[model samples]
Target: MKVLLLVAALVVVGGGIGLVLVMKSAAGPEKQATKVETGDCVQLTGAGKEADAVKAACDNPQTPYVVSVKGTVKGDCPEGFYSYSVATPLRGEGVGLCLGINAQVGLCFDDIKTKTPPPLVNCSGARLKISEVFDKASYVNSPCKEGTEEVISYTAYGATQKFKSATICFVKP
Candidate 1:
């Protein structure tokens, strides 16, 4: 009787442990505890669809883009960092992507009359300048390099209040 009881207990405990291990493995990727900081490399997922941005190692080839700035506003990216914004079709919450400075990326004009946004290109070594328009508060708060010329300005509406956002375009010098 003692031997049978011991065997049964061991089996139950072992089965429970195995079940836990399997569950953890099935939970998908583990959530990142650390907040994404400046200069960290990230991969933008679901492009041209729904955006699901996540942090990735700098050397990871899958994550080619770097975080130049961290904020909720758009078009307020620091000089040299390309700013791109993605919003749901219904104008729900939007996410911003601040590509690394001097990183070869494409450009899309907000005013471009098109059913979809333009494709990205390798605009490296191009004679381009930055044009930005954002909320005054955001502009004043962000740590953008000084002497950034502001070509145009406009009001940006968000899901909630009419918060300001900017559209900084790179043009030929």
Candidate 2:
């Protein structure tokens, strides 16, 4: 009985130590951020769900391109029309889409010839909040020399509240 107890104790202790190590390893250093360069004429048109906005941009019907998501607004994404669109010059040509307020933020890439909708890569900070509208929120996905993700920051109505900040990410597709 004593021997069995000893074995059980050993197992318990070993498990505890393993758990601690795992938790510590999981808590690695914070990732460096990508600075997003705002305002380059990425726009979303029509009205529809946020997803629709993404789809329209992906199905641009105008050019052959790959769309990388920059940012999005969820509140205004319409249900039957293209709500938003943002174009980028990465991977040939990249476009973004949004619906405003609750719309999610992420990356989108499309191949024009086949009109395929590739999976969107949701970067670390891909959330929208009411604060976003007043304070300005943005998506930052610039590549770093080290290959790590870049840090993107958004500032809405810095001092005066005349105009709100533009949607950081999302344009059309």
Candidate 3:
């Protein structure tokens, strides 16, 4: 009788462990605060032209910018792309990333000209609204819709890597 009870208890505990493991796996990998994603938000630290980029949860009110493009070797970021360095900029050890205030359509920005990536704001104060997004960049002629008033493009260049770029279309709200 004692042996049977012990075996039963072990089976129950094993089943519970298996269930927990399954649940954990279904939830997917945990996101690190400093990790990079195409449309995830990040926080910038320091002052003026010198600053550091750290991944921040989109839910955080402070994280106003999302990555529009990554891994750029070009000397400068394309128009409207906010340049960011993953490593210490003083030593030039990190690759560059281009960021945007909104990751997709239906988002708004107030002061894109004066602010890098700008701060995502309510529609009431927004001067521009994101209308479209494309994976290509720098069209000789604007390919956006007739109402589009702003076009921003960012591109990545490396000797061996394939080219990558993104374009965003915006209109006055």
Candidate 4:
């Protein structure tokens, strides 16, 4: 419900573009990003299944997906989660990262379900506006925002049941 400022740095690598978010905070000093783990945010290179994911600043509007379970098999992402595989220079094989929507309050998104990482869009005429997000099994009632048309949420069982995260996403009314 307060103002948060995002600070990122752009780095060019061999004609490709990469962004690193150095600091992020809300009404306070900037917080540094030092590590990557589950529940962290990621920036995708494209909207396809093969899109590469790089750790980005959490709560960033540009970073559409949040890491739900890292180090899992590719294509093992639970419902609402996407699978992204990355190759490490040191390893012969690729690593898998499961991601879900990085839905933040007040941010708007378009093509939420149709795209791998839904495109971020202007709030005006946007398809969805995040009012609040809740981890599954943690909430008891709907908390959608007033005048909201829908509560975005889902649950599904995967092949191996690696890590199924069902988030109760809704707006606070």
Evaluation by lDDT, superior candidate among 2 and 4: 4
Best by lDDT: 3
- Which residue pairs collide, candidate 1? 106-121, 131-168, 133-166
Worst ten-residue run, lDDT, model 3?
26-35
**Candidate 2 per-residue C-alpha lDDT over 1-173 given as tens digits, one digit per residue, 9 for 90 to 100:** 99999999999999999997776566432211111222212222233222122222323322212223234332332221123333321222223332122222334322111222222333343331111111344455332223222222333333533223433223222
What local lDDT score does residue 17 receive in model 2, on the 0 to 100 scale?
A: 100
**Model 3 stretches astray by more than 4 angstroms:** 1-52, 56-79, 83-98, 159-164
Please give the lDDT score for candidate 2.
0.31
- Each candidate structure's TM-score, on Cα atoms with residue i matched to residue i, is 0.36, 0.19, 0.51, 0.55
lDDT (10s digit) by residue, model 1, range 1-173: 99999999999999999998787666433422124545566666565445545777655434545555555534575443556555433333455555542222233232222222223333453334443323332433543345643333223334543223434434543
Alpha-carbon lDDT of model 4: 0.54
Worst 10 residues of 2 by lDDT: 31-40
For every candidate in turn, the CA RMSD to the true structure comes to 10.4, 18.1, 11.1, 16.2
Ranking by lDDT: 3, 4, 1, 2
**Per-prediction backbone clash count:** 3, 45, 0, 3
Model 2 lDDT, residue 127, Cα: 30
TM-score, structure 4 vs. true: 0.55
Error of 2 at 42 (Å): 24
